[model samples]
Target: MTLRDEITNCRICAERFAATKTRHQPRPVPWFTPTARVLIAGQAPGLRVHRSGKPFTDASGDRLRDWLGMPPEVFYDLSRVAIVPMAFCFPGYNAQGYDLPPPKVCGQTWHDRVMAELPQVRLRVLVGGAAHRYHLGTKAGVTETVQNWRAYAPDTFVLPHPSWRNTGWLTKNPWFGEEVLPALKARVKEVLND
Candidate 1:
């Protein structure tokens, strides 16, 4: 079986999910292809993604496409883009109603194995804090890491989660829109085109 299929059919994650206090079933949602040049590495799937079994099928995805200056057809094209989160399954909600952080076990178990299949990836867009930490190691806080984006240029771009929960952060960080988005879109276009 292909590495991609093995990851998609992972029952280890299902067992992990079942053992969670919430006991929700896991539905791994990721897309990978040998030709993909851009990898959208974000946090875990949300309830919406779990229900649909499709990655980035929500408003955050709409905003992410906007950030990349790509329409849905292009952004969702598996041949050009890979969507792999820190955790593949929905990690369930906390008592406060926010989704819980993605389990570290999921990344520990699968990220390296799955990432090994995408040797063509040129741009790794690390969305949210968890992904940044996992890929870039212990760095400054998200804001600082993202503000220092040039340090990881050409190959990696740090971004806050595109969820509406971070809308206030976007408003507060105007430079993200004015300075970062244009450069991000350009790099994304270049990688996908190449």
Candidate 2:
């Protein structure tokens, strides 16, 4: 099946949304190109992205650009990067924090197919715990930490969420700036350069 078809038919996150206090309608269009070299696997959108319908189109986008040292022009280019967030829609939040989980339906319904379409994804950025947990499975844990990132290097990389809440996290994990930042840039440059 085509990427768009698989995404449109996703029932994973949608089911969870139905049970939430706030809900979001899903839009699985804008299937990205296979040439996309960077795959940003993030948590579902927030209230803002739900309204805008563009992935990482909020403050988080700004932080992500800062980390990547990329101008908005290059960062927003779908041809260069594919943004397949864990949950395609903004899966409303809870009082505790974000919420319980990103529907099993998303991975079960569409994730594999979408990844298949984007063969050029060289680096998959696992943003936030849910994205990391789902993508990395039991291999990732809260105690596992972003500090000892080498434990999960190369093909997969863990990142603090780009949300404002992570500014302190960015500060605490200075190595993310000193070490991971350089490597991430080099990787992006290599792909963008090519």
Candidate 2 clash pair list:
12-105, 12-106
In the range 126-181, model 1's lDDT, one tens digit per residue, is 99999999999956788998999889987899999999999999999999999889
Candidate 2 at 15: error in angstroms?
A: 5.8
lDDT of 2 by residue, 130-186 (tens): 777777775656436566567776666677888897778677767789998787777
Q: State each model's C-alpha RMSD to the native.
A: 1.5, 2.6
**CA shift of 45, model 1, Å:** 0.7
Quantify all predictions' global Cα lDDT against the true fold: 0.87, 0.72
Top candidate, metric TM-score: 1
| Ten residues in sequence with the least summed lDDT for candidate 1 | 13-22
Which residue segments of model 1 deviate by more than 4 Å? Answer: 19-22
Q: What's the lDDT for candidate 1?
A: 0.87
